[model samples]
Target: MTEPDDAVPLRRRTAHALDLMAFSLADVRDGLGPFLSIYLLVTHHWDQASIGFVMALGGIAGVIVQTPVGALVDKTTAKRALVIAGAVGVAVAALAMPLLPGFYTIAFLQAVTGIAGSIFSPALAAITLGIVGPRLFSRRVGRNESFRHAGTAWAAVVAGGLAYYFGPVVVFWLLAVMAALSVVATLRVPGDAIDDDVARGMDKATSGQHRGPSGFGVLLHNRRLMIFAVVVFAFHLANAAMLPLVGQKLALHNKEVGTALMSACIVAAQVVMVPVAYLVGAKTDSWGRKPIFLVGFAVLTVRAFLYPLSDNSYWLVGVQLLDGVGAGIFGALFPLVVQDVTHGTGRFNVSLGAITSAWGVGASLSNFVAGGIVVAAGYSVAFMSLGAIAALGFALYLIAMPETATGTDSGPGVFALPHRRQVQRDAVVGGELVEDLDGKV
Candidate 1:
C-alpha cells in the first residue's frame, strides 16, 4: 500500500543499515568459527574432537529452537521487538561465557544462546521481508549477507589477537559488546511497519488454522516439510562441524595466521556476496528456486572436495566464496520458507526456534564427528565428505520440492531489504511466507 501522503517508500538504504547492525553481532561469534574450538582446547583442555561436539550442540539448538520461534513471529505483529529481545539475549549469553565452568558449561551456555538466536533470526528475516517488499530484494539480501560477513572478516583480527594475548574470554567480552549493539540496532526498527504478508498471517491464525501444539504442530502433519527439516538437519551437521575444523586447520599451521585467515576467508566471501546475492537472487526468483539452490550446493560439493586437497593459503579464499554461496542459498531462503509455512506469528517464532535448535544439534554432532574425521580421514576427506552430503540434499530438493517463491516474489529473487516503511512491506499471500510473500526481497 502506497502512503499517498508520502512520495514513496523510504530509501532502500535504511534496510541496509538495519541488516548491517543486526548481523554484526552474529559475526563476532559465528564468523570467528576459527577461534571457538581453540578456546575450548586451551581453556578446558577439551581436545579438537570434544570441542566439535560442543559446537554441534550449539548448532542443534539453533536449528530446533528456530522452528518454534518462527511460529511466534507468524502469530504476532511485534516482529521488531522479537529481534531486539533476541539481540539482547545473544549479548547477555556472550557476556556469560567467561563464567562457564568447563567445555560442557560453555556448550550449555551456547545452547541457550542458540535458542535465543532462533528468535532473533526469523524475526529479522521476517522483518526484512516485510519492509523490503520485492523490488530489489535480492540485492538487499545480498548486501545484508555481505555486511554480516564483513563484520566477521574484520573481527578475524580481533579474535586472533585476543585469543593469542588474553585468551578466548576476551573475545567473548567483545561479542558481548557487539550483541548489545545488535539489540540496540534491532530496536531501531520502526514501530509502524506493516506488510501484506504479515497482516494475512495474523488474520489466518486468529481465524482457526492453528494446529495441535498451540503454535508448534503446524508442520507435524506435512510430509514434505518433515523431509525438508531432516535434510536441512543433515546439511547443518556438516556446516557446524566444518566451521570449527576451519579454525583448527588454520591454527595448526600458524595460530595467528589461521585465525586471521579464517576471518579473512569469510570477509572475502562477504565482499563477493554483494554481486552474487544480486545476480543469483534474481535468478532464484525468476527460474525455479530449486535450480539456483542446485548451483549453490554444486559449488559446495566442489568446495568440500577441494578444501581437503590443498593447504595453500590462497585457495582458502576460493573455498570461502564457494562455501559462502552454499551458505547464502540456504541462509537467505530457509527463513523465508519458515515464514511461508507457519500460520501465526506465535507459531512462526516457535518454528524458528525449532529450526535453530536443530542447527545446534547438527553443529554439535558435527563438532564431535568432524574432529574425529579430521583426525582420521584428514581435512581433505572430511571437507569432501561434507560437500558430498550437501550435494545429496541438493539432489533431493530438485526431485521432491516444487517452486514455492515464484508467483509471489516481488521481482527476481534479488530484493533490497530496507528498514524504512517508505519501502516494501510483508503481505502474507498464502498460508505461509515460504509459499507466499518470500519472493524477491
Candidate 2:
C-alpha cells in the first residue's frame, strides 16, 4: 500500500505498522522447518532417525547463539536490519537446500540458517515493545500473533498447493517470494516511530533512574524468568516433534497424500492459532499470564495423548487443533511475560533470547527422543511418552508459576516507579513531529 499525499490518521498509521510487522513475521516463518521432515522423508527416503538428527541441528544452532544475539539486539539500534538479514538468509538457505549434496552439508547449512534466523525473534520483540511500551504490549503482541499465524496458515496452503502440483521443491520458491515481500514490509515500519529507550525496556520517565544490570545478568538471576524458561523448554521439547511424527505416521499409511495431509495439518493448527492468539491478547491483561500459559501446556498434554488413539488423517488433524490452543496463548504471552519480568532493565530482547535459547534446547532434544522412541517402541508409545512429559510441564507451571500482570507482585518493579504514572506522549502529523516531550517523539 502506498502512502497518502495528505497526512494519515493515527489509526491508519498504526494499522500500516502492524501490517508491515505481520508481513515481516510471515516471511521469517517461511524459513522455519515445518516441511523439512517431509522433504527428507519423501524426497530423500530418509528414516525417522535421520530426519530427527538433521532437524535438531537448527535447534542446536539456536541454543548456541540465542543469548549473544539477543544481547546484541539490546545494544544495537539496527533492530530492523537484523530482521531483514535473518529473513533473507533463511530464504537463501532454504532455496539452496535442493542443490546441496550430502546430509552433513545440509545439516551444516541448516545450522548456518539457524544462526542467521535467530536474530528475528528478539529483535522483533524489541521493536514492538519499544513502539508500544508495556501497557499496550499484550494486545499488540496478540495482534502480532494473529498476523503471524495468518501468514503461517497462508504459507501452508500455498506450499501445499505448489507441492501438490510441482513437488516439494516448489515450496522453496514460495518461501523466496514471501521473503522478498517480508523485506518490503519490514522497510515499511517507520524507523523514527521507535523509541529506543522504551524499546530497550526502560522508560526515562521513571524516577531513581539507574542502569541496573546487563540483560544476561538480570535474566540469569530472575527466578521467575529462569523457571519460565524451564517451563518453555519442557513444553517445546514435547510440542516440536509431534507434527513431524504425524507426517511420518501418515506417510507410513498413505504415502500418496502424505504431503498434502501434512500441509492440511499445519493449516488447521495455524487457522485455530489465529483466533486463539487474538483471544489471548484481548484477555491476558485482565486474566493474567500463568493461567493462560498453563492452559497451553495442558492442551499440549492432552493432544499428545490423543495422537496415538487414531491413524485416521482427519482424527490426527483434529488432535492438532488442540495444539492451536496451546501455541496461540504461548506465542502472544511469552514475550509479554518477558517484557513484564524485565520491564525496566533494558534487557527485554536479551532476556527473551535467553529464554528462547532454553526453548531451543528442549526443541532440539524433542526430535532426537521422539525419533528414538518411535523406532524402539512404536508411534503410540512415543506419543504417550511425550504426553507424559507435557503433563509434567503443566504440573510444574500450575504449582510454581505466579501471576505476572503489571500490578501483580511477581511483575516487574518498573511499573511501580512514580514516573511511570506521569509519562506522556507527543502527537505527530504525517512524518513531521508536532511536538516532542522529554525526548519522546
Candidate 3:
C-alpha cells in the first residue's frame, strides 16, 4: 500500500488531483464531442442523419462497456493507471481520427475511443473518494467541476480560435497536446495518498451494511436508482443536441463566424459553471441535493424553451448562459446523489456506470432524434420539443426524487456563519485531513 508522504500537505494533494481532473476534462472529455459534429458536417459534407449515425457509434460502444468499466475500477488497485491509459487512448484515437478514410472506418475508430474514455469517469471518481473520503467529497467535487468547466471554457477559446484560422482539423491536434498535459497531471498525484478502503466506499462510517459482489441484478432492486436513471436519460435526451444543432444553424447562416459563435456558446455556459459549481459544492451538503438539482432541471427547461425564440447570435449566447446554471448543479450533485444512494453497497462505481449507460444512450440518440426533427420540421419545433421533454423530467424529479441530504452531524449546519472562539479540529489520517459530517477543519 502506498503511504502518503508525511511532508506533503493534504491541501496540495487535493490540488494535484484537481489539476489531473481538470486537465482530463480539457484533454478529451467534452472537447471532442460537440466539435466532432461540426467537423463531420463541415469537412465531410455529411448530412444530419449521417452525422448522427456516426456519433451514435461511440454511444453504442459506451453502453456496452459502461458496467464492465465500473466493475473493473472497483476491483482493480491500478485506478491511476486506468485514468492515464484512458487519457492516452482518447488522445491517440482523436489524433488518428481525422486521417481515417470512409464513414465506417471513422465510426469504428470513434467507437474504440468511446470505450477507452468510458474508464475515465469511474476511475477518477473512485480515486477522489479514496483520497478525500466522503466527508470532503462534496466540496472537492465542486472544485473538480469548477476546474472541469474552466478547462472546457479554455478549450472553447483555444479550439475556436485555432479552428477559425487553421481549420476544424486543428482541434484533433489540440486535443493531443492537452492529453499529454493530463497524463503529466495524473502522474503528479501521489499513489500512496489513495485509501483503497475509502475509495471503494467501504469506510468505517459506511461499513455497517454487509455487501457482496452483487451483479447487475442489484440495479433491478433499487427502484430509486432505476427511476433516477430514467430521469437522467430524459434529461440528456433533451440536453445533448441543442448546442451542436445551434452551431450547425449558425454555420448555415454565417459560415465564417459559426465556429467562433459555437465556442462562444460553450464559453458562456462554462464560465458561468465555474462559480455555480463552486457554490453547489460548498452548499450542496447544507441545502440538500433535491432542491438544488430540481432548480437545475427547471433552468434547463426554461433554457430549452428560450432557444426557439431567437436565432440571433447574441440572443442565443444569452440563452446558453442558463446551461451554466443547470450543468453546474448537475455536475456537482450527480455524483453526490449517486454516493448517497449507494452509500455502503460496495458497488458504487458499477451502479454509477449503470446510470451513465442510460445517460449515454439518451445523449447518443439525442443527435439522431433532434437532427431528424430539424431536417423534417424546423429548429423552433425541435427546441420546443426538447423544452417540453425537460419540463417532464423536472416534474418527475420534483414529484418522485427524495431529498438525499443528511446535513452535518456534529457541527453547526455547514451553511452556518463563522463564530469567534469556535474550536476547529482537522480530521487528518495518514498525513491527510479526513473531515467528518461536521464541517471542521
Best by TM-score: 3
Give lDDT tens digits, candidate 1, residues 167-265.
566667777777776766666555454453543233322445434454336457555555557666677765656656665676667654554556566
Which has the better lDDT: candidate 1, or candidate 2? 2
Model 3 scores a TM of 0.91
* Worst window of 10 by summed lDDT in candidate 1: 427-436
Regions more than 4 Å wrong, model 3 = 1-11, 205-209, 213-215, 408-437
lDDT accuracy of residue 282 in candidate 1: 51
Listed per model in order, the count of residue pairs whose N, CA or C atoms clash below 3 Å is: 109, 1, 2
TM-score of 2: 0.89
lDDT by residue (1-441, candidate 3, tens digit) is 233353336445545655556645554655377778888887778888788777877877887898888888877888888878887888888888889847988788788778877887777787777666667778777878888888888888998998889988887888888777777777766665566656666645555465655546557878777778988888898898888888888777777766778889899999999999989998888789989988999998999889888878889889999999998888888888877777667777888788888888888888788888988998888888888989999999989989877653322111101221112323222224434446544
List per-prediction Cα lDDT, in the order shown.
Answer: 0.58, 0.76, 0.76
lDDT of 2 by residue, 101-160 (tens): 379988987897778778878887777766655665666688788888988888888888
lDDT of 1: 0.58
> Which model, 1 or 3, shows the larger lDDT?
3
